[model samples]
Target chain A: MSHEELDQLRAKLDDKNMELLKLLNERGNLVKKIGEVKSKAGTKRFDPVRERKMLDLIAEENEGPFETTTLQHLFKQVFKASLELMGEDEQKTLLV
Target chain B: MSHEELDQLRAKLDDKNMELLKLLNERGNLVKKIGEVKSKAGTKRFDPVRERKMLDLIAEENEGPFETTTLQHLFKQVFKASLELMGEDEQKTLLV
Candidate 1:
């Protein structure tokens, strides 16, 4: 393959990265909204049962060049970040 | 707000998570293809310059409910996973 082919592939990879970034942010926003609702209802922010269910669903639906374990691990990072983001939003609401 | 509202939000979050999962797998496939090309051309798999550029672009584009730092951290996890995945592909190729 030519050098040009490699460049094209890299460009596509970069585009995919940006798409993933956008979805991450979208997920963050939804998590923040859920956090607000939970706070109002006096429910705990971290529901282990719900988290497990989500992870299980991910494992089931994963059709991957990535291993199921690998995808789960990466997703756990996103899940953790969303939890932290919820904490940040809760704090912001407290200050407001 | 009713319990139904919270359920709706959680459903949306789940949808987003699945979408992210699909995208991640799609990215994994692309990375695998790129790995094959790199192997063919006898080029190094890990390009720090390219990785740095992608991170910089992500940082620039972040309009986050999650902080930029948080998103960057998450993306870095993904980038690292992709690199490791490429390594795995290279090994498989070698075994063939």
Candidate 2:
């Protein structure tokens, strides 16, 4: 590939990165809302059943060169990050 | 919050999940192209300097309920998944 092709690909990747960042923040907003609801209801923050279902759903939908295990692992990280975000908000609310 | 509010929040989360999935696949496509370029150039697959720059950029941009460390860890997983996809493709190309 030429220099131009490489630069174009990198530019595309950067665009995708920005999109991911925006989507993650959007997800974080939803997580905070859900956390508040769960806190009010006296429910647990982490739902193992829902997590499993999400992994299963992703696996089913994946038309991947990526393995199911890799998708599961990556999604697990994403899930954990969202949970941590929600957990931190709950802690702050408790302290206030 | 009421049942209706919870349902709305959950619906929004589902949409975000789908968006994330699409973005991830889009990133994967770029990774594959970059991988091919790197293979031809005999360059390293893992670029620690570039990775650190990305993490720093994310931390700077983060208006987070999540800490920088958490972002770093989560992004490392995302990076790993992309690298794995690229590596697998490289292996297939080698075999052919």
Q: Which candidate is the best by lDDT?
A: 1
lDDT of 2 by residue, B1-96 (tens): 466787788788877877777778878878888988888888888989978877887888777666778767877888998998888888888899
- Candidate 2 structure quality by residue, lDDT tens digits, A1-96: 466787798778877776777778878888889888887888798999877877888887776666778777877888888888887887788799
> Per-residue lDDT for A12-91 in model 1, tens only?
99899889889998888888888888988999999989988988998899888778888888888888888898888878
Clash totals, every prediction = 0, 0
What DockQ does predicted model 2 obtain?
0.65
> What RMSD does each model have against the real structure?
1.1, 1.6
lDDT of 1 at B90: 78
lDDT of 1 at B80: 88
| lDDT value for model 2 | 0.80
Candidate 1 fnat reads 0.85
Q: After best superposition, candidate 1 residue B30: deviation in angstroms?
A: 0.7
TM-score, candidate 2, first chain: 0.93
